[model samples]
Target: MSISRRTVLGGLAAAPALAALAACGGSGGGGTTEITYGYIPDFNGASLLAIADDRGLWEENGLKATLQTFTNGPLQIQALGTGDLDFGYIGPGAMWLPASGKAKVLTVNGVGQADRVIAQPGIDSLEALAGKKVAIPEGTSGDMIVQLALQSAGMSLEDVEKVAMDPSTVVSAFSSGQVDAAGIWYPMIDNIKQQVPDLVELAQNSDFADVMQFPNVMVTSATYPEENEATTLAVLKVLRAAMDVRAEDLDTTVELTAKLTQQDAEAVAADASNGQYYTAAELDALVGDGTVETWLTAMNEYFEENGKIEGETVAPADYFTFDLFTEAGK
Candidate 1:
């Protein structure tokens, strides 16, 4: 299932000439590939692309990456399909749609504890969420985490009143007593606690243990990588190096995320300690073998079981392109 620029333009197949028009404007114009890097302003590795840009690593690597912030991952995904965003530091669950066909995965940049499941004063457990309304962004990693978290309580999304909203709104909705609970991402999780001191902590995504993984990955348009291999490799090199820099300097990383997300640096640093970061060797191994495919397969099935994705389940390998990562490593 190949997705061309015409397919990405969405129903513009009738205008075949537009494809030629886009190519002339998109990097074929004889300059560094002007990359619009999309990211959710969460205090996680996904947002670290902003740090890479802020530190001028992208430029240092011979590419120009423009940082575009999003309120949530789904919006970021939408931009990817329409070609509004050429590159993204996106989450695994949302990465599924593009990984399915629309784009190529450079690598799973980092896995972290980004999402949070918080309840109102009276709702304290996953069981309490069964009949009550729960706010979360549909088709996102946080959505998957919450779905699996419900299973541990012997329930699924069917048992609850699921209100799909943007992560930007979920926190406000949960804090203002509009929803019983919200499965939102970080910084928002930190924001909620500060705004509503009485909000109850139902579960963290990590509480589900091995049943869930909220991974952030780098992705490019399916054709983009093949057409601009050198530029793609440059992007990956900068990101992998950026992760190493992040590990060596926590306070600066937190400050970068805080500045980008507009949250307090201390709050970002304090709550940021919970998620896992991948090592270079660990990332290489995951990309080199079937481990990521295995995770994506599990994620796909989880989505299908929860009715988040329609039709027969797609294979995980279709959603990724490991050769790019392998090339970057070389």
Candidate 2:
């Protein structure tokens, strides 16, 4: 479904105060640059942006930024395609959409191994899941985890009885023994553990870390970078500053994000703990060493092989740029 800005903002009465867009343009006569940014609504999704807002980094950087929340990355990608948003944060799953030439990635915000292949107590190994029924939310990172784990065990989805289930219902089905195992992600992982105390986590994304890497990214419209180089750099600097704040004081960071997202502090903290974030220097190193590129390319290749991509598959260089990110840190 196509989500319009009005439709999205209709129910977001509790969201933080948004800055007014500059009438003249992004910036003029020493006035702050105005930018509309789209972001995901979860903790991992909102942390950096929330922190930036809470810390006055946007204003400090001479920006009048407005933050808008999207239910998911694909919707954000849709908005970007139409030029409704200048920039946005998106998950690895929606990263493939940018290959269609709608948006371009700026930098990696996080590398969170939040997906896992969990099994029943007796089902101790991935190999043992060969004939067992496995619950999975198809087309998610959780599903990809299942595929990679089975591949590691010299098996495939064909070897198992695939039970496609919604993420919200997976725990109930697994607890009732309706499925022998489940390809799941966190928050759900925590809940399932409470219900099935003996749940066996056969594999998580970290287990396949060497071959697979899926990092959440900050992105902009495909032409935003070329048209607004200084503004983009300013935004990156603010994000980098937020990263420093996040690394230094996680408690405050979590609190601000919880408030912005209107989620429970404990749940937000749990989600934050499950993620892997990089500092400005670390991000630079990853970009310089081709680590981030390799990860993005791996993600692209996986989606391409699965026929998830709609158009011609694009390489990392085609959609990602770190030139401004590097300059921002300086």
Q: Which candidate is the best by lDDT?
A: 2
lDDT of 1 by residue, 278-299 (tens): 6556778876777777767776
| RMSD of each predicted structure | 7.6, 4.5
Model 1, runs deviating above 4 Å = 1-33, 45-47, 54-56, 82-84, 121-124, 176-178, 194-198, 259-263, 310-314
TM-score of 1: 0.77
Which pairs of residues collide in model 1?
99-319, 113-275
State the C-alpha lDDT per candidate. Answer: 0.65, 0.78
The TM-scores, one per candidate, come to 0.77, 0.89
Report the lDDT of model 2 for residue 268. Answer: 83
Q: Write the per-residue lDDT of candidate 2 for residues 38-114, one digit (tens) a residue.
A: 87767667888888877778777778788887766766767777887888877766767776567889888988777
Whole-model alpha-carbon lDDT for candidate 1? 0.65
